[model samples]
Target chain A: MSASIYLDHAATAPLAPGVAEVMHDVLVGAPGNPLSQHAEGRAACAHIDAAAEKVAGLIGAEPREIVWTSGATESSNLALRGVAEFIGAGARIVSVVTEHPATRDTLSALAKQGVTVDWLEVDAHGAIDHDALAAAVAQGPDLVSIMQVNNETGVIHDVPAIAEQCAAAGVALHVDAAQSLGRLPIDVSATPIALMSLSAHKIGGPKGIGALYVRRRAPKIGVAAQIIGGGQQRGLRAGTLPTHQIAGFGAAAAQAARHGIASQPEWARLRERLWQGMAPLGGLLRNGRPETAAAPFLSVSVTGVHGAALITGLNEGEPALAVSTGAACSAAKGESSHVVRAMGRSPREAAATIRFSLGPGVDEVAIDAAAQRFRDEVRRLRTLAEAA
Target chain B: MNRGAADDAIRARFLRPTYAVDADAVDAWPASGAADTPGEDARCRVFLAVGNDGRLKAAFAAFGPPVVIACADWICERVTAQTVEITHTVTLADVEKALALTPTQRYAGLLAIDALSNAVINLGQ
Candidate 1:
């Protein structure tokens, strides 16, 4: 058997070059609490500050706006739950039905706590209807929370347009940019986005480290800290920050700034090549609007094959294909993708969906091999189904 | 479902189901019976041919998780050279034990038994 090919970068990307070295240096060399008054503490604080600058630079934000958190999940929790708490009960938040569970579940919890949530629906292509969004904004909700990119289908939401509507309505817009932070060019200064959740692991940084960008400019945003003990991070997120993880995140962000922007077209081309290779199978359906999808993502749902059987065959085949049936977080639930189901596909079709997300090292050769393995698995499963 | 959670027996059988009938040869079988669990999409079909000495030859085709496929293949391998009456006597426990199926995978065993029972009935008619 040949080596396995990894296409599940959406789940977690491998650490990029320079990220591990910085992390190692910080782990071995920097050994003081960032908030302590000692010299070592001051040195640690400087590292954290530099990392924040790099993270801020990637998204065109001031370093002061970045509030470090555990990861995107925590950042989202801080963004949504904190915003809801700040606005108090009876606050209204408008968000899409297909936001990541971090946002969706947080909103659900808030709804139970007396906040009214209006979940905007998406069309079959996983694209939100602008009119529906406009209507939601017209209601003057306190906040409009949406994701910049769909984790399951790679669908890119027009966050700028959404932000425009929210800004005009005098509403705060919180974007879960876990999937978009480095993969896409984001200028928070150019857009009126009030709050954004970001994760480092998704962009080849260390896991368990992320940031929530709280606008410090006009329409300043504030979130009541969910994790509070120490009065660190200006009391917004209170914890002794992980110095090495933060340093690694900054290095990853720097690398993304240096390479991620220029690599978009190449990634998009590879994605297209992958799709074209698998398109000949006839019953395969692309889950999102290709023109609007992120460059690294390609999600397809196959017909005429049992979803479970297909996944098994691909995983067990020689040179196993490392892909996901949906979001890795939800795959273990053994249920169809809610994101795909929300887009109007039946449960079975949603179950059959495969999300192939590319990363930095993936090339055309890997894409072709993955496509061939995908086709072979689908054909094999279809043949078995026909025999039955 | 957690594919790695499957036992080695199930993994081996699922990866290379030796008793699975080829799609082209499915039409040439003397008698075949298929059963599917409606909402779960767990399905199994058993194909049988009576040998010259009144014994049975069996092959299976399945559409479901690896457990279901492995269960169906196990059932076929168990009943291949047995008499039709013996095939009818194959129980759910028999299939479950052979595959080391868990409680969650009990449906695979049931589906296999149902398919084989139907095949036995069809062979009689």
Candidate 2:
């Protein structure tokens, strides 16, 4: 079997080295439910608590303020539903069109439950309209939710600016940091964000574990519980904590802190290398501004080529180039990416976009291979197109 | 997306699609047909070039998912060099069977048939 160069880090990054060992240690060493009052249970609870601290440390939040959930999707649902339920009906919620489906679908459900919904517009470059957002904020909306980094486009919103606006407006802010959690430095205490959603899988940790940072000090926030059972997590979330997964997540978090946004420059250089390598092939259009986007992700749409065809072709080749046509959810749905559509791209462009998200251990040779593979596929498909 | 549902043949055709189209041979035929369809969230255009002797040269342009593209390539390969009247005898089931399309990919077969039927209609034979 030929080795593949994976470029779908936005979907789910591979587990970091040593993370599996940490998880295995916990799985074998601590096998009791965290809820039990026995010594074994206490040992399990200690693992859970240490994991919580690690996750909190990554975002500069108090461990007491973090609530664990199944992953970013559940964290999103819990954050949105919990807050919406707390604020009650007739409250207004504002969010951008480029949010992940977790937040987008939850907001749609909130709309159905009698909360008014207003969508913030994004420009062609995928930047949120600051003036429009300020005006919306002035309308006295109860909550504002925006993603820190767009999953498909890698566009980074001005979270601190948005947080300040929401704070001045007396509106609670929820930042979906799934894409930005490990890639960016997020001090929840300094950002004025009331709630933030984070995922472990996106940061070289295990899947099926995530956390929500609820501001507990200044601008203290409370959320109604979405899942109920043993009244764990102070009633915010309830279940027997997965110590193994939490341990992996904690180890991942600790590892992430050692670098803490220092690798961004290298990531940007590698992204540029791929882009430049393919630019000479022509018909390349970037989906988001590189200056504002996350360093590791480069989303480009090609003219005169089918996006899905390119994706499949790249993956099927020798030394396969594994990338994404869009976000993981929409890619499976076999639909044009909504993030590209929201950026004012034509339906054809939306269908032709490919997201190249890099990760650790991806060297220049792999980037060149990916670029060459992309060029070959585009040429092949375009020749077929012209003939047709 | 889990593409494991598709057989290796279909998967290979979708990936490399060696039978997609030939640039020099497309415009030289005397009779031709074409069809357009809205696929999933994209569009597909299938074209055929027919010789005076009634044989076909098939080519397709698609912006849809892998299933639709592969289906076009599969049908084009099957129909090329066959008599122009073959479109009348061809069934959606034939194309689906040839591609080993999964249930989710069944619509791609319909699309292929639609395009092939339209190409035959455009032949005006």
Candidate 3:
């Protein structure tokens, strides 16, 4: 009867009320563009600057370092290009096999453009081997990109250790901390990260707005203004900043700073509840590590499950329960996750996989209900399938 | 035990006699879902199974001529002219529960729907 038990936080989080209210004020009242020179414009600009400062405080970066973009996809692009081109890093970028498609495909595109690409491999646990990182950086590429927390696996990489390696090699590092910033502690001052990408929607902020932290010194990756206009955001990303969304993102960021630590425990408890519920089922297999992995997302695959059918069935049978079998970006066509495949799961195992992601709103009761419904459905369907 | 992907996709929707499906599509199934090739003889019966990606998973039915009770989504390891014992179950759970029923050495396509634990396994020939 109420809102559905939303477990797919990694897909997109529900906006916080605090963020919503702030955004409402800006959208309803703010008139002139933040870029306009009029008093109205200056008022809007002040609102944007304040919002950026709040976001900067959470990540321990200067407000001047933050440049806004449409969202993570663009933020990621800006980081990769703005640094790579600015340094003219010889078109070769070093990274790992588990990078999100944003970085992976971007590198792949660069590879086609004669950029040398080197990738560090991860073990079954999704941990990057230090030896592999050393090897990938040995040749000295223009830039290296790594995501702080994996979206699907939730595996936390040693970004600082990685930063040290990049620093030693004199390679610029770009950390796609979209999943990490809100849930995990990030101190850009300590970490040798040159460029970092942040998305508002991922942290229960408004959708459309994301930011990039570009260190003035190591600005090698030059993105030739994908949206050239009034040269806003250090001229790297130029457009009329969505003041309302920025205000919402700032509110979300502030809320994230306040309640961030709660996310991990909330997810960990639900995840444990899920594993306990699934223990009796002989065929189920856990996908990745929780604490080391992304705490909010849990992927499990039963020995003989069809992932697409399972997701659809879960959505249909338990209206309050929502889940996914593969990457939400690739959900429309029923393609299995390449991220899982990189972890060495067979296609069948990958197909059987279901991603049970937890959000801030999810509680033990919701977890139990969803798990019970899932088990009941699974048992019923399997029994019937056996009968069929 | 379960409807084969072929059965699930075709069912009543695409099986009309006048349904304009490509002959190549018709050609994929030489001997499944019906008894005998379209023109071959009453002795030859069709078998239906889900095709994972490309190859057939298991034989589910042989409806034309009604030669014995059709075992759905089975490989029909033994298909004689008069009787076709569906050697395996169509769905995965029945296949697992009827473990003694299935031969130990056989390749099959097994996929469990995530929404439910019950698996849909198709034994390939």
Best by DockQ: 1
Estimate, for each residue in B3-118, the C-alpha lDDT of model 2 and write its tens digit.
Answer: 45556677777766756655676665444444444435434456677677867777776555677778888887888899877778888889777777778778877877787787
The alpha-carbon interface RMSD of model 2 comes to 3.8
Model 2 clashing residue pairs (backbone): none
Model 2 chain A poorest 10 in a row by lDDT: A326-335
**Model 2 segments beyond 4 Å from truth?**
A1-3, A327-334, B1-6, B25-31, B39-64, B79-88, B102-125
Each candidate: what lDDT?
0.87, 0.82, 0.64
Worst 10 residues of 1 chain A by lDDT: A326-335
Model 2 chain B: worst 10 consecutive residues (lDDT sum) = B30-39
* Chain A TM-score for predicted structure 1: 0.96
Better of 1 and 3 by DockQ: 1
Please give, for residues A270-365, the per-residue lDDT of candidate 1 as tens digits.
999999999999998889988999999999988887777777777777769988887422123437888998888777777888899898889988
Across B1-125, the per-residue lDDT of candidate 3 in tens digits comes to 24354333222221211212122343454333322222211111223334444433322322111111112222232221212223232344543333222332111212111101111111123
Q: What value does the lDDT take at residue A259 in candidate 3?
A: 85
| Candidate 1, residue B71: lDDT | 91
Which candidate leads in TM-score?
1
Q: For candidate 3, write residues A38-140 as lDDT tens digits.
A: 9989988988999889899888888998989888888888776655565564677888888888898887876776667888778877788888778778877
A1-388: candidate 2 lDDT, tens digit per residue:
1348898888888898899999999999999999899999999999989988999999989899888888999998988888888878677889999899998899998888898889988999999889999999999987898999999999999999999988987888999999999898899868899999999998899999998888886665558999998999888999888989989999999888886488888999999999999999888889898899999999998877766667777777666877878743223244678899888876677778889999887899999988888888888777755644
